[model samples]
Target: MKYVLGHKNPDTDSIISAIAMADFLGDGYMPARSGDLNKESLFVLNEFGIESPELPELNEVEGFVLVDHNQEAQMFDGLDKSKIEMIVDHHNLGGLALLSPIFIRIEPTGCTATIIYKLYKEAAREIPENIKKLLLASILSDTLNFSSPTGTEADKMVANEIARETSIKIDEFAAKMFKAKSDLTGMPISRVVSADYKEFEMGKFNVGIGVFETVDPAPALERKGEIVEAVRELQQEAGVDYIFFAVVDIVVDMAYLIMPTDKEKEVATAIFKGDLEDDVLKIPGVVSRKKQMVPSLQKYLENV
Candidate 1:
């Protein structure tokens, strides 16, 4: 069986892209997730009445197609030993090296679903209504409702096309989706921090970054002490050089970054040119981690 999977700590884009790809590829392909779903992804799946994909055992899959991410650190264990049939991602390539040539589609679009949407057009296949909603949600989530720096005109065009077919207003639906994910009421600090986490290798430094998107930042900020403590624990456990989390206020298009160490704060202030207040930097118009945060940090690391 051919397994279609996405990165671990599955975000909305990662989870939805896996499902959409599996459907597009037909009977032989099975959609799967490498890790547990975040609150946002779960909300999208529930809102659209789509069932969550099963987590696959790496040794059991005959071949695989990766979506959303290509980094081995973000993939399932034992994946390196399996046959990689295809890779469809939107991020920079990492340590994934295949022995043979395979079908690979890596685009600079904001979301992987955008590339998949284009593939649907190329194949002349009609996108199902449910799948259309899923793709729309993924785009909105990854692009921060078209406010993200990573979002492109192609992403807007695809989203508009999908919206017309589904009769879903972009702003209204995005508001509802963001509202659903904003409620992190009972979730533990560790769960909140690890929900949408990702790791990057920046020069000799290992960096782990997490993003928590909410309509208001006050609720998350209220638990600042516990959140910072959790970040420290995570850094120690992962043995990473830097551990950071961004609490993004979707309404105002701002991000409140929590950097546990002084060195991280200095690097962040240098990259974003913002003052750090109590180890939290309030950065304006900095929403996309993939587009802004990661790239800026990588450049800084490269220099130093």
Candidate 2:
């Protein structure tokens, strides 16, 4: 049996794309995740009566149809490293194995779910009402409901189609989804960081951690200290050679990269092709990891 899955930090796009792929593969395939679904995603699943498959034992299985996330750490507990036959992701691509996939689909689009939605359309497959709801929710979550730098015209089109099929008032559903996500008051900083952690290796010299935050103003300012401390703690615990987190201000188009080491600053300076100001780097009008960050960093690493 084939297992379609994604990273442990299973975001909406990852979750929805895996399910959609399973739909395409029919009954012989299983849709799975590396860990627990976030509260917001869980709420959507419950509303649609879509039960998450039991967390799969990362053991022997047919080749994996990886989606949304490609980090090796997201695999099943004991699955062979070579068994990941396919990979589909939209995040910063680093640390990928030399011969990891037989079919790799990496796009610069905002959401992997959008890509899956396109595949369904191309194949002339009717997206089930429940699955459409999930895909629409994934687009809204990842794009911050059309208010994110990651959003694109294609994303908007897919979202509209899914909402129409699901009979959901898009605006109303998105408002509720954001409200649920922004209710981050009591959650620990560690949990918040883990909610969206992506680890990247920069050559053999540095490792970075990137986390996305969608909150603004008061809440974001309130959480900054906690986030900085949490990043420090994670650096030690994860034992990465170096760690950094870029807090992207969606409206301002500037990034405040928080790091515990100067090596991170050095790498950022080289990658962004900008000087470090006050020892804090800035990437003006910079957004989109796939389109901007990863490509720049890869070149910088290669040169170094």
The numbered model that scores best in lDDT is 1
Please, what are the lDDT tens digits per residue for candidate 1 over residues 3-119?
999998888899999999999999999999988887778888998999999898766789899999988778876775348788899999886777788999999999999999988
- Tens-digit per-residue lDDT, 203-293, candidate 2: 6645555655444434644566777788788888877776767665555555666655677788787667544654446566664554567
Model 1 bad stretches (over 4 Å): none
* Model 2 lDDT, residue 203, Cα: 65
Alpha carbon lDDT at 199, candidate 1: 91
Off by over 4 Å in 2: 71-77, 91-101, 248-254, 269-287
Best TM-score goes to which candidate? 1
Candidate 2 local distance difference test against the native: 0.71
RMSD over all Cα atoms, model 2: 3.4
For model 2, which pairs clash? 58-76, 58-77
Stretch of 10 with least lDDT, candidate 1: 75-84
